[model samples]
Target: MFSFLDKFSSPVKAMLILTFFGIIGSALVAVSYTVTKAQIAANERAVLTHHLAVLVPDNLHDNDLLSDSLQVTDAQALGIAEPVTVYRARYQGLPVAIILNVVAPDGYSGKIYLLVAIAYDGTLLGVRVVSHQETPGLGDGIEERHSNWILSFAGKSLINPLENDWKVKRDGGVFDQFSGATITPRAVVKAVHHALQYYWEQRERLFL
Candidate 1:
């Protein structure tokens, strides 16, 4: 006494229903992501633009970040594995500052990424750590807050690294070291020293 409708009520029908719902759900997710992608991209661009502004002087105007020439190979030659971007911050079409990426591969835990902007004569306009893996509380002073140690890096030059003049005070350098964290400042000093050298060596390529 099999009923014809019993076949339609079987697991196959349930599977079909489930499959249909899955397809619809996936399509909805895909559409939602596609629609929101532009907004997400715009937000990311805004963040980058803001960070770039911190490097440029307030008096300057007409800054175009994208127009600045970028070179990946030159960065690689200098031991930077990641793509490094260079921005020419101009005041009335005259170069005023140079914003570039610096990589500190010898960080205590891992690599530390930095954005450094310097005037043509080598005055450090600003230095911001874009990314890092140092100890959460102990080594994070490199940022703008916990400690103003990073500020000391400004105005230093490659001509006088003063390794004796560029170390954490604990190590007898002019810069202050974290009370409980030595490696962090040590790594930062080395990175800044290397970055200054790299900047001088690449000035020709960067300016043009």
Candidate 2:
């Protein structure tokens, strides 16, 4: 008749206990990671779907934007360290629009992230400020809820305003800058311009 620890010495019993618990802990961690990973991915998809819908109209695309996506690793142009994901919207087997995730590395306070929607013909459908840390009431005008300044970017493109006219009013551009917040708008304008440049360079691959 063997007791729980009868086959092992005192030291061996302690080692066995630790090993048992170690295995249990590792398994728990693996299980937790698997479940949490799936949840995180689902939440991310839902958020992307919402952003795409806001930028590209519902009737414009027939396929799933979340599934129809590609990644671009750009730092100097995009102002981001990680790979940027470009979501494509297709209509009736043809490319309709491409929504880009871009960052303005020179915002007043910090980076001003954006989701820019561009049509197949190089026209801007919409622009949404994803995140920013600019001063309240002043730099916040870039946000749609704060003011309509953001809407001014709609129907715009590289040639629409002319490349040189992409700057803020303070710098002699077509767009207006906030009374006391020039840096924020300036940064956003430059960023939007860069996004267009990127789309132009990758238009062939993007449409494919």
Candidate with the greatest lDDT versus the true structure: 2
lDDT of 2: 0.90
Instruction: Name the runs in model 2 displaced over 4 angstroms.
Output: 1-45
True-vs-predicted CA distance for residue 114, candidate 2, Å:
0.5
Best by TM-score: 1
Once model 2 is optimally superposed onto the true structure by TM-score, how far is the C-alpha of residue 36 displaced, in angstroms?
A: 9.5
lDDT of 2 by residue, 1-208 (tens): 2378788998988888888889999999999999999999898777667878989978998998878999988787787989998989999989999999999999989999999999998999989988799999899999988999999998999999998999988899999999988999999999999999989888889877
In order, candidate lDDTs are 0.73, 0.90
Q: What's the CA error at residue 197 for candidate 2, in Å?
A: 1.1
Q: Give TM-scores for every candidate, taking all chains together and pairing residue i with residue i.
A: 0.80, 0.79
- Steric clash pairs (candidate 2): none
* Residue 69 C-alpha lDDT in model 2: 90
